[model samples]
Target: MSDPHLTPNWSTSALLTIDVQRDFLSEAPYGVPGTTEVLPALARLTAAFRTARRPIVRLYRRDGQDADLVRRTLLAGGAAIVAPGSAGSAVAADLLPPGAPPLDPDLLLAGRPQPLGEHEVALFKPRWGAFYRTELDELLRGWGVDTVVVAGCNFPNCPRATLVEASERDYRVVLAEDAVSGLHDIGRAEVTGIGVGLRSVQDITASLTFQEVS
Candidate 1:
């Protein structure tokens, strides 16, 4: 597999921002350490993708009655994390571009895409992997995206699962190293061994080509 880090075709790539919702950044109860630390890098990359007119898919988690057994067990005990329509379920306000619509929990939880901008949309993933039982692959295909750049909270969880799934499906994958949490050198080595290209947000932003909006 060719390494996307060396020659990223920005025009053929889409950015996938996974599970960066407010709940995941809170202290205790639901917080994932290191998530908040990556916000600035994620924001910058998001802006660059928006400027370049490339597809941006924001994948948020929404826990509902149909959630997996573990999540449902937590919810049964009255955990309020990422429940649909709750403030915690919403994407971080600063990560959104100006005038981007708030995530539509109804549409997202139904596994449908909610338009957030001309080239950005939000989708909900019931599981750790966004491609599992979701329309993500089809949506990316429709937009002509052959490669996926992934960044978001918790590397060992959603982000890692999504990266592996993307690779299994044969999409050239790039892991935005500085823009994802829970990442360490060992994990980095593991993914790289499987042909996942790793790059910093600065490198990605510099390689992107911006298209002026009329």
Candidate 2:
């Protein structure tokens, strides 16, 4: 008894990755544990989307005065947690295409998206959800996207918020489970409860390749 609405429509799908900045990767300040381990799979999904000529959007956090209470405290205490224009605030190198311009922190913080590749762009998420105070929803709508394949650094915060909000907005949402970090059994059950279909990196890339062939 599969949920028809939950099935992935890859042809109309876009990939949205949340909070994959270097500051969230290993060996960086305030890096989330387990974020470093999932890079390979995340990279594969990114590359596959590029090859498929589908839209890819990278959402990163650039903490500022508008940052959340916890982060604001850290920022006030002299923490350079993804500080604007810092190398540590840029997307993880491997997660981006080669020669992609460094992220424009000013542009992002001002609520504008910066081009990353021909079919890809990066934007800043001021809060946990990508759609909050950002152009993400409008961008996807203008591109005629109704399905979003989500992956990235952590599941509990940004990824989870993005998925739930995507569902709330009536997009068919699929989680590249193996391509995101901070996931556990309960989290899996939770996402499924919200009708987020889960797939591995292999499944997503293979499905895209199959679509291309057919």
Candidate 3:
């Protein structure tokens, strides 16, 4: 349970951008306050991961055909938050690499990973935790990633849930503090108590050794 941020290995680490979709940011029906504020930091982190050739998993939240009771109720009530195939369900354009392939709701809802770039892919989560019913763990294992660096929408929900799930699975977890929303001192303490290390985007980027594109 040592601090993974103190001595990091970029090669074995993957950056998980959780729920950075338009539906979860300000002005959206289900927006999390301060979600939009973290975009610049997340953008920096994304670029750093791309340059380092580390894997990036952009986890999006989607309303599935078999959504849970809460979501089903909301949908029945006419809330279109993150409804599949809606514009609001899309990942923010600023967060995606230029020319990144459009997200396929069918693929995502079916638990398939959509390729974004050489070392990046997008997958959809059915609920608060990315690992709940998704192939995230398998995908990371296939990429040989032993550490997870998480950033995005809201710390109280998806980010926190994903971090705990990663820790439970024995993956070294690092929280990109400034690149996520809804994080306060108490929430951070809760995360660190569970052996999750926290670092700012700058600290993470500085730890990486980027190679020249060949």
Please, what is the TM-score per model?
Answer: 0.92, 0.96, 0.92
Q: Can you list the residue pairs that collide in candidate 1?
A: none
lDDT string, candidate 1, 15-68, tens digits: 999999999984646889988889999999998998888899999887768787
The deviation in Å at residue 178 for candidate 2 is: 0.8
Q: Lowest-scoring 10 consecutive residues by lDDT in candidate 1?
A: 1-10
Best by TM-score: 2
On lDDT, the candidate that comes out on top is: 2
How would you encode candidate 2's per-residue C-alpha lDDT over 55-108 as one tens digit per residue?
Answer: 999998878788988778878888888888888887786778778888787788
Q: What lDDT score is found at residue 20 in candidate 1? A: 93
Query: How many Å off is the CA of 165 in candidate 3?
Result: 0.6
* Higher-ranked by TM-score: 2 or 3: 2
Q: Write the per-residue lDDT of candidate 3 for residues 1-214, one digit (tens) a residue.
A: 3444434556789999998989889777778899898999999999998888889999988764667676787777777888788888888767787789778988887789999988899988888888888999999999898889999998998899999899899888899999999999999999988888889999888876443332
Off by over 4 Å in 1: 1-7, 26-28, 210-214
Q: What residue pairs clash in candidate 2, if any at all?
A: none
Structural RMSD, model 2: 1.2
